[model samples]
Target: MSENIQKKIEDLREELHQHNYNYYTLDEPTISDFEFDLKLKELQELEKNHPEFYDSNSPTLRVGGEITKNFPTVQHQFRMYSLDNSYDFNDLEDWEKRVQKALNKPVEFVAELKYDGASISILYENGKLKEAVTRGDGFQGDEITPNVKTVSEIPMQLHGDFPDRFFIRGEIYLTRKNFDKINKRREEEGLDPFMNPRNTASGSLKIQDSAEVRKRGLSAVLYQYISSEFPAKTHWELLQKAKSWGFHISEQAKLCKTLDEVKAFITHWDTARHQLGFDIDGIVIKVNDLSQQRSLGYTAKSPRWAMAYKFKAEKVETELEKVTYQVGRTGAITPVANLKPVLLAGTVVKRASLHNEDIIKKLGLHEHDFVFVEKGGEIIPKIVGVNLDKRNPENPEIQYIKTCPECGTELVKIEDQAIHFCPNELHCPPQVVGRMIHYVSRKALNIENLGQETIEQLYREKLVENPADFYALKKEQLLPLERMAEKSAQNIISGIEKSKEIPFEKVLYGIGIKHVGETVAKKLAKNFESIDE
Candidate 1:
């Protein structure tokens, strides 16, 4: 690669990096996906044709498209604690009594919206954004500062006075509007949409390229100041200060003086929560007085000063339109119920996972059958049971398919198994991609640079068909492909090489052998000496 090509690669990297920072952290994208991809492709093409000229900061490497053998732990500055939960009014009432007793007077509780998403801690120093980390098991978390910096609402610099080290806790959420749009785009592009907003938010945060994070449109809401120099006597006061600092704080907070008031606040939101734009699972109640909070202390998992008042799932009767089949990556054929679009748990429920063929037969479901659909775990809408009386004789009974939908392979039902599997593991295109994905999974070979989309691209391009073929990939072969750069290819090669020296157990697990899990693979590795053995 010539110096001119190297310079061009560096320039492209800087440009893409700037765009990603602007879009993700600033929430102000100036270019569309097509435009960004076009630029990335151009850079990739340049670096591919000249392997020596690849830049590490290029947008294509954001996925880290390389495998990570291990995730080194880092202890947190403060203990990342969990919140105590109260499922019933009785439990909540008891919690209020404890708070009142601790205070020795009438206590005012601050009730805020509880988000159903990934918890993150944002640290700032000298009014500039410093680090962002996940609440990993409440003790230590992965340093995702680079990825977290892309979140737009999380200010890179504080608005007011600078603090030495301030930690703020927030929920990273994907809005209903953005989620729908993302799914719609996925559908149009013939890709499976994300299972839920929580999954999407988690995946988006892990993207190595800061530019990719900007495109996902993730939002954050600061609820608690974990550690701050700014002193506040109550949770409500801390929220006010957070709002002043330009962090998005919950507006639905209510100050209640008694258990009755707290109950009223919870009850009001139970029905009215649907009006909110984002997904909120419950109300988080915190003791207003800081002294009482300190005295209450914490349990092993959750803090006693705080309790989540979860809303009950709303169930309604709806007609089962039909039952469909979805093939899993493992070739398991699971049934899905097609329901009449009905509002459930603040979202429209058109379909629900049916688990397996056994469930379909057990439900005795048929078309135009009146079925009671309940919001499973307050998220997924599931068919609880069918009202046989409402079943019309004119409608035909549901039947499971004998063949795989994609490859027309004969589906097999093994003994003692509920799911039907398509036995064409090696022949089926989906299965091939699935196997490749498993081999490159985090817990297996830990190939960090490989991604589902990239695998699909390789499959579509006929560059690879099996796990072994991945090892044969060369720098020249990757550079010519869209979005593949010299640096990206090298990174992937390095990641693949790192996988070779990993324990035999990981290699065994990566093969996706039937009846062999991580524990079994470890056992096999311990018995064997090498990967070949």
Candidate 2:
């Protein structure tokens, strides 16, 4: 209740807010990082002692992103739309012509980098963040506000925002630095490294634990202001206004007066885009005039006013060390190429998918052959061709894997599928262990303490055989297992107890059924009243 403390609190809030605005938006900060940190720490201490003085706008709210058990899907205020794609400049010219024909005049365009990450919609009600939504099916999305808050780049509370309702659209991306670090951590933990940043970013948002999402150190950038209570006249003006509101805005945006200028912009960044920290597949060209965009309207799937000028997949030559086959939970065998660790796109490439024996044979893939690899969809690395010039004629002809890699059984090829299948589903160690791992994965039963290694050990000892056996584990049984301490056993028991209360859909997913994913499981669970039926 002291006037001096209140004054100091108010002053610090204003100071920190202004500094953040300067640093994030304006790119000019009066205070150094340490000075700003000290002020923020002081304000946090004061707010801790006097909770009444704390407000939503306080900088401290940015760090403590909440944890939630699940993310409920929410309907978007505005139906999110994708942009029509263009692979070449001719397509861009044709698109520009369409815009001109629609508007009866030449159109100006704003060309910006198209980030290869999850598209997110953030709804700010009365200048406060309400929901961080995924672009699920365009009409509806999952509300991942808790996990989104963990991204410090995404401001929890906007600064100098006047909109009563703000519908902000942006990309939630993992930086190359963070992606590498995350993969390193995954490798250290004996987990397969994430294939790409975009998918990882997408998958991370849905994790039940927001704390894990925070540890991923996700980042975002605001490009299209999507919607707001206060409508802007032009795309450039909207971005400028968004910048002033303490949002992370990309500096690569440029307003072009003609199609030629737009082409020049795209041509300029085609090779230079690799310099950026984040993954960008192409440039998004949009009609700068908002009125023109509205008049141009939209197609069934995408906005006619905007076009994503996609770049060709970058390819590099790397020696194929060998081919490795993996057994899926469904017992389908997929061949993978072990490459001589080459750097592709923005990340390192140690291996690439061969897809099937058909691909391997078509490419004439042989041991110690020079192979040309490309990032399929600019996310996954794959061997596209065999460089015959560097291959030795004396090398043995390409011999595809004929038997199951794990089980000593002959692999069978289905009539239509190019993939080989291991028929030893009942006794194959990999199939059983893989199925068990899939059953307890995060999207299924979500058993916390039971990892793939533990599942394999249990399977080896014949302690558990089916999904139902997971629910029947005892403390005595766990006590006999290697590295299973009393506390660890109790935790596993607790985790299993918690998992039992999960909805029917999770149970359906946990059963390791063929052709049933999360969506299918949800549909099945909704259709069937009970499992016995």
Candidate 3:
């Protein structure tokens, strides 16, 4: 390894993530899509051969950023892990060679559909469902038992003969049919439809309201049999046993005896994936025998015996109508690409993110230009490049702005910062309201019924200015608002009063201090004990 392998990894990680944001989050890509994939390939190869450089938050993870601290965290008895990804057959072949070398024997692999969904860990005690947790950081996750129980497919009580205590890992997903229905309903109700089944499933799994999660129609299919006393020697046997115990294992899972068979399975799914009701991004190939998997062992972040072969993301073309800007809580002004509504990856996207001025300039974009869009991670729609051959000459070239959208103040671009900042944080309406909203967010004050709309209304009415004023709110004052009812006002005030007893970390997080989050707040609370200290 190079002396700067660690630095190489860090630099690659940063470069790849910058591209990912431009591609995925902003719908803008500074590099060609093929070049971007090559970068990911480089990073994955480095991480695979040298596991020590593995970073959990690597762009390769494309890890969900939907975590909220409202739910209690649960530590897993066995560490949950991610699988290494293989973009092509050669990568898969190389992985098998490594596994065979580790065990010094030919290996039979079991192939299963890699569902494009969220992962969950469920525990059973005495053959009864005990707890379910989101796979957070591969060790500790959020306990979402109540919400998980809403998924009708997951049996609350196991029926067949089974272990007294056991664990199961599964991919929680929303079927495409159900996802469309939900989206249609959302669109009819004038709410922005969900982006994809994977995100919808992830967001659903963490909901506090079981009834709402149930309506989301989420389902789970067991992917692994986990426990201190793992019984079956072969993975195939475990799947059959899990299915017999009322756990739904995907019918598409196949037992493969060789790498050729695994490739066949991958090829079969690549074309046939659209036929399946639920979205599947790739195929997972694992050593058939559990003993082989143990011997093959694991890296810091992924299983050595298993690897995921991802299908190429589908691409589409759409028209960019205009560019708009929005301000984040941190005061960074981000450019947004307002596109003529088009359906990609089963969701209608009215707009895609443009990231910043640099990304805008790189694409050489113009208003009303034709651009090609692709779901970069099969999660977010991004513009890889403009369709230059079809560029509209009549439309004007895209121009950058200098003023903050929330407040008409001149924006400041700090040295070494990619984003422009609004210096007028004190009076910017969006920043003020954004801060107030964050203070009462579920991860902070956790004030129930005080949503963004309510906070904005309170600010506009001058009924509340800062977070401290919330506790002092009078029910009489709330009644004068547009549609506030006597009971609603009482509930709001009651919820506000209840927040007074929240932990000191939560209070610190709610304080809206720059660079402070729940984790930082918790650290401060633990060391200081009191604010003065």
In candidate 1, residue 154 scores what lDDT? 68
Model 3 gets an lDDT of 0.80
In the range 286-308, model 2's lDDT, one tens digit per residue, is: 99998888888889999988999
For candidate 3, the TM-score is 0.61
Clashing residue pairs for model 2: none
Per-candidate TM-score against the hidden true structure = 0.65, 0.70, 0.61
Q: After superposition, how far is residue 484 of candidate 2 from its true place, in Å?
A: 24
Question: 1-533 in candidate 3: lDDT tens per residue?
Answer: 56588888889977875664454333457999799888888988888878977654465543223333489989988999898998988898788778877888878989999998899999988765788898999889999877776665666556567899988999899987899898776533223468788898898877665666777878778879987677778999999888777677888899988889989999988878867888888999989988888887889999998899988987778899888888876687878888888877556877776778888899999888999877654334777789988986888899888898778999999888788889888788877777777777766777887877788899999988777788788998899998888888888998898998999998898877888876899899999887678
lDDT of 1 by residue, 39-107 (tens): 989987887788776543346554333433343466789888877778899998888777767667767
Any idea what lDDT model 2 has? 0.82
RMSD of each: 9.8, 6.8, 17.7
lDDT of each: 0.77, 0.82, 0.80
Instruction: Name the top lDDT candidate.
Output: 2
List candidate 2 stretches off by more than 4 Å. 2-10, 29-38, 159-161, 227-232, 317-351, 355-362, 368-370, 377-380, 387-394, 400-533
Q: What order do candidates take by lDDT, descending?
A: 2, 3, 1
